[model samples]
Target: MSLFLGLDIGTSAVKAIIIDAEDREQASAVAPLSIDHPHPLWSEQHPDAWWAASAAVLDRLAADHPKLMSGVAALGLSGQMLGVALIDAAGRPIRPAPLWNDSRAGAECAELDVKVADFAGIAGARPMPGFSAPKILWLSRHEPEALKRTRCILLTKDYVRLCLTGEAISDRADSSATLLMDTQAGTWSPQLAEACGISTGLLPELVESGEVGGTLRPELARRFGLRSNLPIAGGAGDNMAGAIGAGVVRTGDAYISLGTSGVYFVANDRFVPARGQGMHTHRHAVPGLFGQHGCVLSAASALNWVAGILGVVSIERFLAEIEAADLPPADIPVFSPYLGGERTPHDDPLATATLSNLRGAAGPLHIGRGVIEGVAFAIADCHDALIAAGASIGTIALVGGGARSRFWGQLIATVIDRPLLLPPLALLGPALGAARLARQASGGGLSHEGDRHGMTMLEPRAGWRPGLEERRAIYRQHYAKLPV
Candidate 1:
């Protein structure tokens, strides 16, 4: 059977999924990786660790199914976005990659925002510390030696693609996150690059998502027990891949992703910068299209913080407790999910998470449930922005760790006033999406019909009030009063 490999490099782990030409899953493997935080708000990872994880997972898949490696038509890559992976002249990472969560470059992002205010018609988004440009500037100013020797700055997937194919290239979806690309033009912007202190030499060549890059090297293929000359497709951003996995490819399609960060993405037919409309714009995985995406920087990370603070005795026990809590009918405490900062609406890195009502009755369970609700509310805010910006959402596909909980999914439906669609294979979200893309790119006979056999629809229960209306008012007042 012909198979395609879809490797997703996330912040916590590297996942490899093997899918047949029909987009059916053959096998999957996951290998965990570690991130280093040398300082506060600084996340870095060794590129070697990623490579090792990828190889390990590939080996595991090959061992499980001997024929899984044969006739591998195409390979697709997906990864956590906004990380800056600098390589020297030999196409090797000089140091650990500074990750998307790194916030040391807040000032640089602020400077870039001011510099590009007038020319924002092309970039389609404001600069933020979580982007590649600020991260690059931080490295250049702090680590002058590394900056001087840097030959190219690659996003996470771009770096991985380089290991597979000798070519140094980046996809437009990931390139849009760099703040240096003119997203509308689908080309690198010299003006923005110069403002960010980045030269064209340090940038990787940009390519479309489905376009072919290069063939796999013989040595790497042999190492993984795969045949040489496998094709590499221009993969996509992690969110985009997740969206695809959730079957969000059509216009007006919506998907809510609760990975490390949370995003509410709506697909559009053409490039529309809802720039001043509060949502950020990025090149979609589907070529010649764009996405209106709203991000909450510390969505799942806020839950992680709660888990850490309350001992890790049993995650199941904690989840059960929160799941059984008495949910409010109309109004609830204002729960701000911004632990590190926020991305959408305000884009403030200094914003802090705050629970408006902590009185004598609140406990860890309340806080936990509130965190989920808070993230949902943040997503609801984004939904409102998309609506105001003329995006008529048709469906809501919820995929992420939070989707595993019935309470959270239902609450999202009520809060956003849309039914939440949870496919049975939600856990395999991004991997399945990348697998589908890989199959299509390789001329695989994957059925594109809307089977949705594994999908579950979560409708709002009766008497589920629109808590978002009150929450929206409170959020606006709170944000207006924020001391930025």
Candidate 2:
């Protein structure tokens, strides 16, 4: 039984899973995480919280399935990307790490846009407040003292890796999106670093996503019910891991991750920087391949927020009833879905959410249905942006927590007017993908791209298109007057 553990340090939680040789999930656990918004546009989580959550998750997994965990051969990691977690020479986090959705670095992003020549061409991602470099730039000016104390910089998963291995390392696939790497060269770019008021020395050593990052520490190994020599694979960022998990390795293959944030990912054989469009052209976890992504700052998170506002306790039941009601287009209000601003296409950091066309009789169902359709429309916007950027679109795979809703998936497919592929383990694709990487790192493979044969497909219904199209126009109208 060659078992592997896959852990994802996501924005909302730390999820850990153990899988066997047949790609069967043997054990799993999750620990919830909360973000801090100290200021209007700030979003942060102490690096300690991630490590704490990770430890708790691992401890639970080990306790629940000690025998299964003891048989684990290796571990793989995956998580959110492109935010700075600064640690000092004393091996202490300087402050709470600014997260990927933090929009406080808007001014710094503009500075880099002007300072770094050919910003998009060099970094393969648009200069945005959500990226890592700008977050560092924001720190450099706002809190120079913190930068002075910083010895090493890490991304979300790498920070947790530092805790697990006592080594500072990162994967190329995750680092490529940091705006500090030369996308074409696949190496740290000193010029880009300098423009962001930092140097390559602050960054961690880069490794291939499937290579051994470091061995687990003796103490943590005992806690995990594993041997000290258990290797941790150089895991990928969520998008890359999600791609590999969904068997999106071949060129023109794509997946739509309806996770905390919405990501439209397309695999490519070569660098395809979609200049002018907000698509990210970066390295893939699969060696020697590139990927393009259209990221929506808020996807499922936006819907979750609206649900909370409506005082709905059971999200599944709320969505079920909304799906049952099948409200007409006129009853569903227009939703902007920009709770934390946006990234793809608009790149507006100040954009706010809006629910328009609300009637006096509008209740939770109307509001809930509106938000659902709104997210689908927002996804369509991502599809259009990627298509305009010349990314080849074929059948799309939908993978994430939001994909659990049949109505939501169908609605999104209808809005995009495309079919969707649903993998059996769609909800935790990144973790599963990380396990796949772990298998590769151990030189013990169990599956191939051809394994996608078991995936189920969701075809769009033409009946829902016309009404959704009319509402999407209203949604666009609201977005056009954004940055409010």
Candidate 3:
């Protein structure tokens, strides 16, 4: 049986999985990663750390599934999008990469809008601090020497691909989030590059998500105990890969992801950006398709925070306690899930998380329920924005770590007032999507019917409608009063 490997370079970890042609997972491994926050609102990681994590995971996979590793035909990579990985001419990182959650480029965002004419029209999104272009601009102003020495600027996963194949390339799905791509044209925008005081030559070459980026280098292959000629598929950003993994390829297919961040992602057959409203538009991993998403900086992370605050040893335990308490929805306090700032509908990086109207009687259970409700409301905010932008969201596939919670899934459905479809193994969506891309890059045809196996559905409870609506209104009131 032919096998494909998928590597995900995520914000907090690196995960790899091996899957056979029939999409059966043979083996998988993950390595934890750390982010450096040297300053407020700054998230950075060394590119070499990503390489180390990738190597460690690959080593584990090779050890556990030697047969699968040996027969692996192609590999695909996915990662957090909008990060800036600056590499010098010799393919070495000049500095730690500014990650997607980094918000140190506020001034540069204003400058970019001024320097680049019609920036929104070209980039298909507002200039935000989390994007690659603003980080590049920040470097140009503060770290001019490093910017000058920069020979290539690649996204997170592309840098990993560089280490594996000795080539620098990126996919459209990742590049489109950079605020430097002419998203509609599927190319780098010279005007945006000039605004950042850089040249387009510094950007990696762009390709479709499933295209062959490069083959594994002989030396690197030997080090990892793999084939020398293994092809590396141009994988996608985490959102796009998650969509693919959920079988959301055609128009009107959408999903809500509740991971470190929360996202409302919808596939589009044509380019339609909601830049004015702070939503994101990027190319899909599948060719000739586009994706629009609204992102909230905190999702399940908020629940984890509540768990930690409650002194609970496990999130599952904390959630169970909250559910057992049977806290009424109307009594739940309001929480604004802006712990790491926010994206989508409000491009405010300085925004902080808020919990309001907590009664003296409220305790850990109340707070926990509020956190879940807050996250659901935040996602619903994005959903409303998407609908306003003319997205016809019918049924949403809920995917991510948070989807493991039946309580949270039901809450999201109630708050969003939409039917939620939970695919089997939803947490593995991004990895599975990467494997699918690898299969295509290795000359295999796409047939994701297997992806839909054992799907489950969650419909909104009509009885919960009024209470959720009241909670949403209160959230809106408190959100409006938040200090900008």
Candidate 4:
């Protein structure tokens, strides 16, 4: 009678859920999180806000389902990777955490490229402005006072873990993306930390994803109506944990996540840094496994932005109307999906999204279609980048809020020129993946393996290829000329 609770501290929100031993979800809750963009290329959030949201969500879960909450044998966490939360000696955040998509560290990234030898091969990524290490350097130069008080630097989910357990720790899966880890060794790199103007002492202790990080504190347990001293499993980064939720455990397994941020993830049995290809090489929650992924800063966020502009209340409804109208693809303008800059294939934080080739004949529907097409094309760029970096691809499972729209999923499939699989209950991916880690921590078998059911296979529709190829060419040309 084991129950596992998993929580994801995402950029947009915190999603928490509880699952029984049989892997069926018993209860779930979501609490929205807002990001502050005080300046261009800046994304920050207070660490206390994250804990407040998770605490409220968990307390609600306990209030609603006391039985399920009591049965929880262990808990797990998953979250956005590459975010840096600096905690003082009193376990208080010294300042707002810099988010993964924050690009203020571009100059710092350049300095690292010149500082670290074989930078890409060593870091398992190019010195991108969005990674945690560069951001720490940015803080060192821009906000030295905060760094002086910092006792530990934690990734997003690890920040939550510190709150729940009163321990400073992180797992390989999340820490690997911090650019302070030697990806192959699966350990923190003092050299990298020194380069970032920090010491390894500031990092959370590294653990395997399924390993027990710390027990739940008594006060938290009483508030959440769970057993005191319940072990907390070390959870992976959202994308890596999400790969688990999507059943992408084995080598060559792949999936696409279209959330606030879009991710193209592929599993590998061992570390294979696809450096300079704009992909992240990260540890999988599964032991001895690794994942390579590319990210687009905007995906459903881009779609939702257009929907808001068009005054559409329901996304599914709007997409339905677009599909019903059968809008001619060529009539749509080309859109660049870089609303918050880009990572995969571009790695350019200064890049801006664009909508070009607009004509008076183009209506809202046309603009909507173009936005959708542009996102799909950008994801395809992620796919192409990975392939050129020497990773193989096949059918990909779609995982995220976007999976609900067949219109969006099918369009992405057509753009990638590969079949896509949409798993049932796709939106629960990262949190569910965290729950799966909890299950593992509780001594259960790897239950997520090979249990594919109720998944829809999407194929590339024939009619879209030719017109999209021409459109994609224009989109690429637009990118070639874009920086503003």
Candidate 5:
């Protein structure tokens, strides 16, 4: 049986998997990685580090499952998006990549918003500092030497693709996040590229998410003890790949991801710009499709923060305490959840997380439950906006680190007032999505059509609905009283 490789280049780590053409996992490996934050608003990782991690992961997989190596037929890659990985003429990294989480280009973003009024019309979304165009401008102005020496600009996955295939290429789904592509047309935007003072000559040729770019290079193949003929398929941004992995491929299909940050994504068949300024509309991995996603600065990260503050308690113990706590006080509390400001509803870094209506009786359990409920409510706000804008969201699929907790999933379902579908596999996340892409590229594999084999449904508890409603009402009353 032929096998496929799925490599996910994530912010914190790199995970690689070997799955048969049937989508059955044969071997898996993960390598721990870290990023460098040289400044308050900067996040970067050495481009070489990704290559190192990929090599480590592939070597370990081959070592663990020797039988699967020879059968590997194709490789697909998925990665954290919107990175600015500039490279020299020789294809060497010029500097550490500015990651998606780095927001230092805020001023540059404001400038683009002013200079490019048709930005939303062409791209389906507004430009943010977390995107690449602004980062490119930042490099040109702040690091002129590096910019002058640069001959290629790549995203996280694109860099990996280059190392494997010796070809610098990017997919539309990944390019869209860089704020440099014409999302509706699925092409590079000369207008935006010109405004950013970037030379289009250095950008990689764009392709679709599943298109074969090139065969793996000989040296890379030998290092991993694999064949150089294995096809390398175009991979997408982590969120798009995660969406595919979570089975949110159909129109109106939804999923809420809570990792370091949060995203609520709804797939749409046609490109549609959201009316609200808060939500982002971007192209989907499947060509000619788009999605409107809302961003929440903190999701499980806030919970993690609370846990650490209260002394590193296990998630099980935390939830048990929440379950034992007297039903959340009947009174509503307003929670901003802006431990680091917000992204969707309000794009303000100065916005602080404020929980109003907390009395002396409120303890850590109430706080924990409130934080989880607050995140769900925030997602609901996004869904409501999407619905108002004519996007139908029938149900939400939960995928991310946060979805692993049944208690949290239940709370989200109750608060959001929708059934939550959880894919059976969690470790697979984007890597599984990459495998699905790999299989699709190979002509035939397990289909993503079935409802039973890959999903677990979480419905709002019959008894919990009333309490959720009451809590929502209380939250609204308090939230309304706050200054806009």
Candidate 6:
């Protein structure tokens, strides 16, 4: 049986998985990665570190699962979006790459808004500090020398792809989020590049997500113990890959991803920009489709913070406590999951989290429940934005690390008041999606039968409606009063 490999260069780690022709996972591995914060509101990682991590994970998979590695037909990549890696003509990174969570370019964002008239209409989203364009502007002002030497600009995964294939190319799905791409046209915008004080020649060539980027370079392939002619798909950004992995290919198909960050992604058949409301309209991994998303800067990360504060040694234990508490609506505290600031609806990077109505008796359990509810409320805010934009949302597929908890799933269902579908392999959303893309690039057709199997559905409990409604009202009131 032919095998496909998928690699995800995520914010917290680099993960790799091998799947057979039937979409059954044969082996998977992950290597942890670190972020640098040299100054306040800054998040950067070395492009070399990403390549090292990717190589390490692939090395482990090849060592332990030789048979799986030997039959690998193709590889696909997915990674965090909006991060920029400046590479010189020699393909070496000139400086550290700013990440998606980086917020040091606030001033540059305003500059772009002024420099590029009709910014939202052209770029398909409002200028935000997390995007590549602002980061480039920041470099232009602060690190002009590095910007001067920069010959090619690549996103996170595309940098790794360069190492593997000796090519500098990115997919339309990832390019659309850069604030430098004409999303509707599925190409880079030279006009936007000029406005950002950068030359258009620096952007990587764009391709469809499932198209072949190139074959693995012979030397790298031999060094990594892989086939020489292995094809690499022009993969996607994390959220778009997650949507593809969840079979959210058609219009109206939506998925809620609760990774380190939260994303509510809806597939649309046509280009629909929601820039005014701080929502995003990005190209989808699937051809000819677009993805509309509302992103929360922190989702499961908020839960992780609560776990640390509560001194819970294991996430399992923390989740157990949440499942057991079952706090009634009136007793639950209200929380805002803005630990990393916010994106959708409110584009404030300085927004701090708030916990309200904490009684003298309130403890970790109440706070935990509140944190979960807060994330749900944030997603509901996004849901409302999509609805306001005239997008229809039906059953939502809930995927990611936080979706592992039955209680959390049910809570989100009640908060959003929508039926939720949980694929058995939901946690592997991006990697699996990347593998599927790899399969397609190799001229293989994947059967949707496997995707439709082993699914669990969670419906909002009627009993929880009253409590959810009451808490939602309080949440909205507090959210409005938050210091922006």
Best candidate (score: lDDT): 2
C-alpha root-mean-square deviation, each candidate: 2.5, 1.3, 1.3, 1.2, 2.6, 1.4
Worst 10 residues of 1 by lDDT: 444-453
Q: Which stretches in model 2 have alpha-carbon errors above 4 Å?
A: 446-450
lDDT of 6 at 454: 78
- On residues 200-317, what C-alpha lDDT tens digit does candidate 3 reach at each position? 9999888788899989999878767788899999999999998988888888899999988998999989788666666878888888888988998899888888788778788887
As a TM-score, model 3 comes out at 0.97
The Cα error of candidate 6 at residue 80, in Å, is 0.7
- The deviation in Å at residue 22 for candidate 5 is 3.1
Error of 3 at 263 (Å): 1.1
TM-score of each: 0.92, 0.98, 0.97, 0.98, 0.92, 0.97
lDDT of 3: 0.87
**TM-score, model 2 to reference:** 0.98
Q: Per-residue lDDT for 233-328 in model 5, tens only?
A: 887888888887877777888888877778888998978875354677788887767877888777887888778877855976787777776455
Tens-digit lDDT track for model 6 on 1-484?
Answer: 8889999999999999998887888899999998899999999999999999999998898789877787899999999898889999899999989999999999988888888878878777888878888888888899989989999999999999999989999999999999898889887898999887887799888888898987899987776678888999999999998997887887888999998999999998888877666687889998888888899888998998888998978886777887787766667898889887788778888878888978776888888889988999998888888888777776589999888887888988888888899988898989988998999889986335666567899999889888878888888787578764
The regions of model 6 sitting more than 4 angstroms off are none
In terms of lDDT, which candidate is stronger, 1 or 2? 2
The weakest ten consecutive residues by lDDT in model 3 span: 445-454
Model 5 stretches with alpha carbons more than 4 Å out: 324-327, 330-334, 355-357, 451-454, 462-484
Which model, 1 or 4, shows the larger TM-score?
Answer: 4
Question: Which candidate would rank higher by lDDT, 3 or 5?
Answer: 3
How many clashes show up per model? Answer: 1, 0, 0, 0, 0, 0
User: Model-by-model lDDT, in order?
Assistant: 0.77, 0.88, 0.87, 0.87, 0.78, 0.87
Task: Flag regions of model 3 displaced more than 4 Å.
Answer: none
Instruction: Tell me the tens digit of each residue's lDDT in model 2 across 1-484.
Output: 8899999999999999888877888889999999999989999999999999999999998888889888999999999898689999977899999999998998887888888778888899768878898989889998999999999999989999999999999999999999899987879999999988888999999999999999999998898898778999999999999998888887898999889999999988888776655567889998888998988888889888988888989999998999898777777888988888878878888888888999887899999889888888888888999888888886688999998897899998899988898888788689998998899899987256444777777889998899998988889899777544
Which ten-residue region of model 4 has the weakest summed lDDT? 445-454
